[model samples]
Target: MVEWFVGVQVVIAVLAGTAAIVVGLAGVKPNDYTLGATLLVEALLVVQLVMAIIAPAFGNVATGSGLEFWIYLVSAILIPPAAVMWGLIERNRWSSVVLGVACLSIAVMVYRMSQIWFVQLA
Candidate 1:
């Protein structure tokens, strides 16, 4: 994964997650605002997937275990959609909280992926 792109993903995920949590705390139900934010996080993950596919061609291969990185990326990509589905089905304030938690989880996963990609064993 690209370092700068990973940074962007983490920042956006954190911002979106925080916003969703605040909205949830305010007793807001499942709404477009939270759904859209989750979608944005999912989109970035899709982009990261594409980058992973092509980055090796550019000599930007991971420094750590490729399997571990792929597992993290794949799991991260799935969390947002699952959370969104749960939110849509439940239609409650806690749904927004779920989305926020999912985004935060994605942020953590993405950071782990970055570490796996860029570790320099000396």
Candidate 2:
């Protein structure tokens, strides 16, 4: 729900997406940097998740309950790891592209999560 954190996610997603595209155009196969991006995003999402918990604990009530918040939390936790692991299985630069897509998707999700948290209405 933090405005600052949503900005962070957008920045991360754009940077990661750019790298993924550049890597794809270069024809190098996927490498450790892809994993690096995964880790970077995971760190950001963890920030979001922690903040999500704290906001309500501090009595910042949303129209929904904490469980709704955790759905986004769990989704954010689960999706990037799955994408990173899938990139490992696929083993192509194209797979990095896929991971980048996931990164962008998470950014979108984070924004949506903020809306779910911040807006007064459902």
Candidate 3:
């Protein structure tokens, strides 16, 4: 993955994580603004998924073993939506809690993804 994209993802992840925490702390009422912002984070992941596929396809080693990296990228893409869906099923503060946790986690996955690519590149 490009450094710029990782930078963006990191920035958004931090912001979304903060928003999630705020939402969770404020109680069960869903904030439209926060949800909108959260969707942006997911959208960013979706972009990462697309880029992951393209970068590898073009013989670029954004992450080593392009296909394998994509698998991890795809998993990262799946997690937030699944968490959100699970939250919806419950329809309470816990959903926000899930989202909050998911928001924090993607950053770690992003870092792992970075390591996977860079460690091998080195």
Estimate the TM-score of every prediction. 0.97, 0.84, 0.81
Q: Please give, for residues 23-122, the per-residue lDDT of candidate 1 as tens digits.
A: 9989999799899999999999999999999999999989898988999999998999999999999998999999999999999999999998998442
**Which model scores highest in lDDT?**
1
lDDT of 3 by residue, 10-107 (tens): 78887887777777777864455555556777898888777766775676575355566667778878887787666667667767767877877888
Number of backbone-clashing residue pairs for each candidate, in the order shown = 0, 0, 0
The top-ranked prediction according to TM-score is: 1
Residue-level error in angstroms, candidate 2, position 52: 1.0
Model 3 / residue 20 / CA error / Å: 0.8
* Candidate 2 clash pair list: none
Candidate scoring better on TM-score of 1 and 2: 1
Model 3 lDDT on a 0 to 1 scale = 0.73
| Candidate 2 structure quality by residue, lDDT tens digits, 1-122 | 67887888878877886787678667756678876887788888888777776776777666655576678779878887888788878887788787778887877777777777777475
Candidate 1 TM-score over all chains jointly: 0.97
Candidate 1: where is the Cα deviation over 4 Å? 120-122
Q: lDDT at 66 for candidate 2?
A: 53
